[model samples]
Every structure is written in structure tokens, then in C-alpha cells.
Target: MKIMVLSSYAPTLFLFREDMMNAMLENGHQVIAAAPEPEEEWESKFKKRNIKYVSIKGIERTGANPIKDIKGFFSILKAIKREKPDKIIAYQAKTIAYGCIAAKILNVNEIYALMGGLGSIIRNKNKKSLARNILKAEYKIAFKSCNKVFFQNKDDCNEAVGTGLIKNEKIVMINGSGVNLEKFTKKQIPAKPVFLFIGRILKDKGVIEYIKAAETVKERYPEARIQILGSFDTNPTAIKEEYIYKYVNEGLIEYLGSTNDVRPYLEKCQVFVLPSYHEGTSKSMLEAMATGRPIITTDAPGCREPVINEGNGFLVPVSNVEKLAEKMIWMIEHQDKVEEMGRESLKICREKYDVKKVNDVILKTMDLKKVRKNQNVI
Candidate 1:
């Protein structure tokens, strides 16, 4: 089988789907990735793995010129015809919408659309915006054309169903892209309570709330550590760099900056926190669980899935800095439960979200088993 996975961002595929592509390759299927041109380091890594890549720029969010969008659609269709892939899996908003259109023309046997998040298009309160309305229509068409629509959370699945974007049978739920357990294994919980946040610094990701909560926690547990590691995003909702710098300078939180590997920092943390407004299934939360770090996230959709309050960690109201702070304070006051919660976090990941297990479900949903069984080529 030949499979092409497409996304708008380089980091997303490099970080999340690279292992899955390698797994498919090990199983004797050809794999290729289509993404925006990545940095030299990412390009080098792909070359080392012998993964083919096609650079498709200007296909990002807010780059919605109809002319470029039309060109992108046909360009992808041409690529599909040339590669003749048996399946195409797409992530991110624009890629999924266009990939579905191209797959229809190419008559691809299987198309998997990953709704990583409903994103601002649907999550934003303003439903009357022209862009949002257009996006909604595009999603309806994309979902109708997809062989399987993968959702990270129940809310996204339910929303799509309610909007008549997809039939109940077409939706498949998976843990937010599974974490690499071996890569993010258990570590010794820090001697002093440490709370870490890892994700792009976007307003919708609740960076402001996390900052306020950190300040509140410090008032009670002055020795408590709060660290944030992630790059600023170009998304409209991104936090200003100056604000992040101010927080770092004020000792509200230690900004460790972004890194390719987060495991080293996760090892030194007792709690992983993400007070994001929502998520498809937060990959960072999954990694925190795999690394045996207790989690404290919001009670909203995608963010709440990995947490079982009092078992792994706690959940507070989204955007409520005071409540988030109280939860952090509780974690600090009862430091003895850190490791116990960490143990439970790891247990949950191992049982419910092992990468192999989640990837297997994706393969089965694509009907790869039936395809191979009928071919009987092995």
C-alpha cells in the first residue's frame, strides 16, 4: 500500500505521524509526507529515514485566497495521480478540506480525515463570520467524502454529527495522537513540586490562565516551580512574546523556550498542566501520562479526556485562573500524592493509549486488514 499523509505544519507530521509512517514502512507499505517546507534539520531527519516529502506552501490557515486554494486542490490531485496512493490521511483544517476534494477526483481507495481540533472556526462564538460559514460548508463536504473521520475527543465527534457533517458510523475516536511510551517513560518525580506547561503559546491554549494560576500558587507555595516550554505561534490567538518575557522576568514562570524533545523536562516535573480552552486530544497530556507525570488541565472537551480527577490529577474550569490556582495549590500542599498520581497516569496511558494500540485501530479503521486479507500477498 502507498499512503500519503498531509498537513500544513512541518512540526505536526514530524512530531506526531513520523513514527506511524515508520511503522507502516516496517510493514512493507510505501509512505510519503506532504507538508510545508520544513527547516533544514527537519529535512535532514526525513532524508535519513528515506521518507519522501513534497513541499506545499501557502496552504496554511488564514491563507485562504481562493485562487491559491483552487491551485492547491489541483496540485494535490496531480500528486495523487502521479503517486497513485491507496490511501490518503490528512490533518489540520485546510489540508483535510482540500485533501478530501483531491481524493474524490483521484478515486483514492481510502481517505482518513483527522479533526485535531474544531479550532477557532467552530469554537469561536461568532458563527456569522463569512470565513467560519465557508469553513463549515467545506467541512460538511469533506466529512461526507471521507472513508473515516478521526476525532480526538467526543465533543468534536458529537459536534460534527450534530452539524450533519458526518454520519455516526463514519466517526472513529482515538486518543489524541498516541504518545511514544518508550521515548517518554517514567521518571523520578521532583523533590519539590513542579508544574510544567508544554504547547504552543496561544491565547486559546490558556497561557494567560496558566500565568495567573502560577502567580496565585506562588503566593501560597513560594517554593513551587512553574515552567513553560513552547514556541510562540503565528495563530491569531497567540500570546505576545513581550508578555511571555515579562512573566519569565517576574519569576511568575520559567520560560525554558522550545525544544525538540520534552522528555528531559518532563522528568523533572511532578505535574503537567494545560488549561487550554479545548483540544482534539492533547498530545502533550498523553505524553505527560506516558512519562508518569500527574496532569492538571481544564474541564473542557479535548483537554479533559486524559484526566480522571483524584486519580491522575485534577481539572479546573477553563479560563478560571483562581480555580486553576487552587488546584495547583492543592497539588503542592499534598506532595505525597504526586508519585501515586504519576503511577496512575502511566497506567492509564499504557492501558488506553499505547501508540501501537491506537495506531492499530487507525489501520483497522482504514480497512487495511481486509485489503491485505483479500490480496493474500503476504
Candidate 2:
């Protein structure tokens, strides 16, 4: 069987869904990955894994130009017509919408979409209602033929149902893109208390709030270290380079620019922090958990799923710098309990967010399991 996985961002397929691709391959299915133009390195990586990578044009990560979106829709339609895959699986908002529409047009059966997050349309306060309404309408149209819509969190699923984009029966909630435990094995907590935040440096991610909390934490505990690791994003809410540099110059944060691998940074920190306003299920938080690091995140949709207050990590109110500071300070002061919390994080990862388990759920739900079984591939 042929299975095509579509995403707006190319790297996301490798970074977050490689296990799923590999699973399909192991099950004797041909896998094709469709996304925006990929980096040469990523292209080589996918080739090494025997997965074909097809570039789709005009799928911008930040903007909403209708003409460009229409062009992207046609690009996907063209790919579907050429490849004629047996199943279509798409993730991210734009890809899911366009891919599903293309699949439906091509008369493809077994169409699936993974709603990673509702994206900025739902969270950006500055967005016009008209734009939101248009997006909602597009989602309704795109998902009309989806055999399954996988949501990373229950909150996102509920919101989709509430908006009438999809019914409750069509929804399948999975733990965020699961962590590879073998790759992100537990590490010893750093001796000097380090708090790390990883994600695109966007306002909605609460980057500013994290910086403020870091400033407050540093004043009380001069020995504590605060680190920020992520790229400056092109999103409208992205933190400006100047602001990041100012914080770095003031010694408030140790700014490590974008990295291809986060395990090294994860190894050096005792706690992971993502005070994001929302999320689909934060892959970073799950990675931190697999590495046995306690987390500090906001109590919002995607951000709150991986944490159990006072268990694996603490959950502060969204955009509350003061509370975020308090939690960071408390984590530092109560160093003795940090290891215990870290253990709990690893336990949760094992029980709920292992990559194999998540992929199994995905494959079975897509009915690929039955196909593989009939082929005697599993």
C-alpha cells in the first residue's frame, strides 16, 4: 500500500513524525512525504530512510493570502493525481485543509488529518473576526470527507466539535507527537539549577513572560541559570532579535540560537519551561519528560497536557510572569524534590507518550494495521 503524509513544514515530518513514517515502511507500505521545500540535509535524511519527499509550493507558515493558498491547493492536487497514494495523512492546519480537499477531489479513500494545534487564528487576539470566520468555514469544508481527525489534545478536539468543524465521533485524541525514549533517555540533573525554554520565540509562546520571569528569578537566586533555545520566527508574534539580544547582554538569559538537536540542551537542564499560551501537545515538553526533566508551563490547552501540578511540573497561569517566576524560584529552592519530579516525568512519558505506542494508535485508527496484517508484514 502507498501512504502519503503531508505537512506544511517539511522538517516537522522528520522531527515529529519520523517514527510513524518508519512504522508504515516496516509494515510493508510505501511512504511519500509532501511538504514545503525541504533543506538539503532533510532531503538526504528522508532519502536515506527510503521515503520520497515531494515539494509543495506556496504554503506559507505565517500568512493567509488567498491566492497563495489556492496555488498551494492546486500543488497538492497535482501531487495526489501523480502519486495516487492509497491513503493520505496530513498534519498542521493548512496542509490538513488542502490535503483533505485534494484527496476528496481525487476520490481517495482513507483520508486522515492530525490537528496539531488550532494555530494563531484561534489564539491571536489581533486577528479580525472575519478572518477567523473564513478559516472556520474552510476547516468545515476541508474536513467534510476526512475519515479520521486526530487531535493532540482533548481541548482542541472539543473546540473543533464546538465549532462544528467535525463531530465527536470523527475525533481521535492522542498524546502530542510522542517522544523517542531511546533517543531522549533520562539524564542526571545539572548540579547548578538550570531552567530551559525551547520553542519558536513567539509572543504566543510567552517568550516575553519567560524573560520577565527569568529576570525576577535571577534577582532572588543569582546562581540559577535561565536559558532560551529556539529560532527567531517569522510569525507576527515573534520576539524581535533586538529584544533577545538585550536580555542576553543584560545576562538575564543565555541565548542559544536554533539547534538541530535539543537533547544536549535537555541534558544540561534540570527543568524545562514552555509558558506558551496554547499548544497541540508540546513535543519539547514530552522530550523533556523522556529525559526526566520536570516541566514548568502554562495551564492552557496544549501546554497543560503533559504536566500534573506538583507531580511532573508546575502549571502557572497564562502570561503571568509573577507566578512563572515563583515556580522557577520554587524549583530552584526545592532542589531536593527536583529529582523526584523528574522521575515522575519519565514515568508519564513511558506510560503515555512513547513514540511506538502513539504510532500504533495512529496506524490502527487509519486501518493500516489490518492492511499490514493481511499482507503478513507485521
Candidate 3:
């Protein structure tokens, strides 16, 4: 089968979907990846495995320009025509909205849409906005041709059902883009307390709340290190570098700029935190869990899925700086418990969030061939 995986961001090809695509190739499917402004490195990373990369110049990762999006839809349609894929899996907000429509036009078999997160468009409080309404309608249209819509969390699935975006029968749930356990292997918890947040600097990611919580925690335990690793984003609610830098300058939190690999940071941190307002399921949180780091995230939607509330870690209320700080302080005070919780985190990850396990569910749900263990062609 010729499987085409569409994405708005190229890096996600490596970060989020690498295992799934590799599994498809191992099953003897020809893999084609399409993204906006694809990096040259993509070819070197995938071409040898017979996974082709296609550039869809019309797609933009952020903002709403009808003219541009319309062009993007057409480009996707053209790409579908050219690739003539046997199966199509589209992810990210814009890509799913456009790619599904294109797949439908070409009568592609086994069309799948991954809603990694409801994202700002669906989660935004301002539902009356023209852009939001338009996207909602586009989503309804996209659902028509989608054989299945994979959601990372139950909350997102419920939200879609409530909003009539798609019928409940079409919905499927999977762990947040599964973690590569082998790549993100368990590490010993650092003796020194280091709490880390890994994600885009966006208000939706609760970065501001994380910052505020850091301020509160650090004032009490001045020795505790609060670090953030991620890059600036183009989201409307993105935190300005200046604002994050202000805290960095104040020595409250150490801002380690973005990195292609996060294993080093995950190894260094004893606990991972993400107070995101919502998520389809947070990939960063899962990666940390896979690396044996206890989690400290919100009780909201996807953010809450991985937590067991004192099992692997604590789940504070969303945007609650006080509670978030309280958990941070608790982790700092009970370093012994941190190691125990970290072990639980790794156990849970190995059981439920391993890339192979999660991908097997996806492939079985899509009726695609599932690659057995030790058969990864990548």
C-alpha cells in the first residue's frame, strides 16, 4: 500500500510520527510524507527507507489567510492526485482540515485524521469568531471522508461528539503520539532537584502559569531549579520571548532554548511539568514519563490522561498557580518519593504508551498491517 502521511510541520514527521511511518514501511507500504516548507534534512532522514517527502507550499503552521488556505487545500488535492496513495493519515489542525478533503476527492482508501489536540481553534473561548466558525465548518466537511478520527484523549473525543464534528462511531482513542521507549529510555532520577517543562511557549500550554508557579516555588526553595525547554511559537497566545526572558533574567527559571532532541533534558529532570489548558494528549509529558521522570500536569483533558493522582505524579487544577507550585514544592521536599513515582511513570509508559503498542492499536484500527516486534525496517 502507498501510505501518505500529511502534516503542517515537518519536524513532527520526526518527533511525533516517525514510529508509525516506520511501522508502515516495515509492513511493506510505500510511505509518503507531505508538509509545508519541508526541510532538506527530511529526505536524508526518510528517503533511504523509501519514505518520500512532498512539499505543500500553500500550508501555513499559523494564522488564517483564506486565500493561502484555499491554495493549501488545492495543493493537497494536487498532491493526493500525484501520489495516488492507498491510505492517507493527516495530522495537525490545518493539514487534517485540508488533507482529508483532498483524500476524499481522490477516493483514497483508509483515510485517517489525527487530532493531536483540539488546538486553539477548537479550544479557543471565542467561539463566535469568524475564523473559528469557518474552521468548524471545514472540520465537518473533513469528517465526511474520514474513515476514522484518532484523538489522544477522551475529552477531545467527547468534545467532537458534543459539537457534532463527527459521529462517535468514527472516533478512536490512542495515547498521545506514543513515546519511543528505546530512544527515551529510563534514567536515574537526578539527586539534585530539577523540574522541567518542555513545550511551545504558549499561553494555552500554561507557560504563564508554569512561570508564575515557578516564581512561587523558587521563593520558598531557592535551590530548586525550574527549567523550560522549547521554542517560541506563532500561536496568537504565544508567550513573547521577552516575557519568558524576563523571568530567565530574574533567575527564576532557566530557559534552555529549543533542541532537536530532548532526552538529555528529560534525563536531567526529576519531574516533568505541563500545566496546559488542554491537549489531545501531550507528547512531551509522555516522553518525560518514558524517560522515568514523574509528571506534574493539569487535571484538564489530555493533560490528565497520563497521571494517576499520586500514582506517578500529582495533577493540579488547570491554570492554578498555587496548586501547581504546591505540587512542585512537594516533589522537591520528598525526593525519595520522586524516585518511586519515576519508576511508576516508566512502568505506565512501557505498558500503555510505548510506540509499538500504541502504533499497533492505530494500525489495527485502520485495518493496516501491524509490524511485529523486532521487525522495524527503519
Candidate 4:
């Protein structure tokens, strides 16, 4: 069987979906990864794993441009025609919308859409209803023939169903792109207190709230460190470079920029924080849990899924800088409990969020194993 996985970002295919892709290949299935403006490094990475990489043109990850999106739709349709895949799995908004439509037109046997998150348009409170309505209609059309739609959290699934974008029968809620426990092993808690945030520096991700919380916490515990790891995004809600530079210049937090491997940063942090407004499932939070770091995230949607309310870590109210700061201070004061919480985090990750187990569930759900004659049971 041939499988085609589509994503807006090339690195995401290798970063988050590597385990799934590898499982498909080990099962004697061919995998072709498609993305727009693919990085050269990702092409080499895919080649090393024996997965074919193809570039899809005119995909802008941020906005909605009809002309560009139409071109992108045709490009994906052409790719589907060329690959003749037995199954098509697409992640994120644009890719899922366009990929599913293309696969349907090509008469692909199975189409899977992975809703990583509702994009900024749907989440943006400031946006007009017209745009959201239009997007919902597009989703409904794209998912009309979808075999199954995977969601990272129940909130997203419920919202899609509520909006009539997809039927209840088509939804499958899985742990947010499960973390590789082997790769992100538990590490000893660092001596110095450190809080880490990883993701695109977007406003909706609660970057402003994080900064405010950091400021409040730092005034009390000057010795404690607040660090951010991620690159600037093209999203309209992205945090400006100047704003980040101001924080760095003021010595409020350390900006480590972006890196391929976040394990090193995760290892050094005592707590992982993401005060996001919403998420399908936060991959960074899962990785932090796997790395034995206590989590400090918002009580909203996907952000709250991994947390067990003072179990693995504390969950503060969304956009509540005071509560966020309070939790950080509490963690600092009771340093001994950090290790215990981190251990629980690692335990939960091993049991519920292991990549291999998650991938197995996905493969079984898609019935991919039965479709391949030489499938390897990895």
C-alpha cells in the first residue's frame, strides 16, 4: 500500500509524524511526504528514511489567499494523481482541506484528516463571523468524503461537530501527536529553577501573558530563569521581533531562538509552561512531560488535556498572569515536589502518550496493517 502524508510545514512531517511514517515503511508500505516550500534539510532527512519528499506549491501557512490556495489545491490534486496512494493523511488546516478534496477527486480508497488545531481565524475573537463561516463551509465540503478525521483533543472534535464541519461518526480523538518516550527520556531536574516555553511566539499562544508572568515571577525570584525556544512565525498574531528583543534586552527572559532538538532545553527546565488560548494538542507540552518536566499550562482546551490538576502540574486560568506567576512561585518554593510531579509526568507519558503505542492505534484505526501483505508488526 502507498501512503501519502500532507502537511503545510515539511519539518513537522519529520518531527511529529516520524514514528507514524517509519511504522508505515517497516510494514512494507511506501510513504510519500508532501509539503510546501520544503526545506532542503528535510528532503535529505526523508531520503535517509526511504520516504519520498514532494513539494506542493503556493501554500501560505498563515492567511487565506484564494488565488494561491487554488493553485495549491491543484498542485495537491496533481500529486495525488501521480502517487496513486491507497491512503492519504493530512495535518493542519490548509493541507487537510485541500488534501482531502484532492484525494476524494482522485478516488483514493481512504482519506484521513488530522486536525492539529482550529486555526487563528476560528480562534480569533476579533475576527468577523463571515470568515469563520466560510472556513467551516470549506471544512464541511472537504470532509464530506473523508474516511476518518483525527483530533488531538475532545474540544476540537466537539467544536467541529457543533459547527457541522464533520459528523460525529468521523471523529477520533487521540493524544496530541504522542511523544517518543525513548527519545525524550526523563532527565534529572536541574539545580537552578528554570521555566521553559516552546512553540511559535504567537499572541494567541499567550506569549504576552507568559512574559507578564515571567516579569512578576522574576521580580520576586531574580535568580530563577525564564526561557523561550521557538522561531518567529508568519501568523498574523505572531509576536514582533522588537517586542521579543525588548524582553531580552530588559533581561526578563532568555530567548534561545529555535533548534531542531528541544530535548537539551527540556532537560534543563524544571517546569514547562504553555499558556495557550487553545490547541488541538500541544506537542511541546507532551515532550516536556516525557522529559520529566513538570507542566504549567492554561486550563483551556488542548492545553489542559495532559495535566491532572496539581497532579503532574498546576493549571492556571487562561491569560491569568497573576495565577501563572503564583504557580511559578509555588513551584520555586516547593522545589522537592517538582521531582515527584515530573516523575508522574514521565509515568503518564509512558503509559498514555508513547509514540509507538499512539502510532499503533492510528494504524489499527486506519486498517493499514491489514492492507499490506508484507506488513511488519513493529
Question: lDDT scores for all predictions?
Answer: 0.83, 0.87, 0.87, 0.87
**Model 1 misplaced stretches (Cα beyond 4 Å):** 38-43, 369-378
Across 171-223, the per-residue lDDT of candidate 4 in tens digits comes to 88788789887798989999899999999999989989999999999999999
lDDT of 3: 0.87
RMSD of 4: 2.2
Predictions ranked by lDDT, top down?
A: 2, 4, 3, 1
Candidate 4 lDDT at 169 equals 90
Error of 4 at 261 (Å): 0.2
Q: lDDT tens digits, residues 135-232, model 2?
A: 78778987887998889987888888886888888888888889898889999998798999999999999999999999899999988889999998
Query: What tens-digit string does per-residue lDDT give for candidate 1 at 116-168?
Result: 98997677668678777888888888888898899988998888888777899
Against the true structure, what is each candidate's TM-score?
0.94, 0.95, 0.96, 0.96
Find the 10 residues in a row with the least total lDDT in model 3. 369-378
TM-score for predicted model 2 compared with the true structure: 0.95
lDDT of 3 by residue, 158-277 (tens): 888898889999988888888888898888888988999999999999999998998888888899999999999998888899999898999999999999999999888889999999
**Of candidates 4 and 3, the better by lDDT:** 4
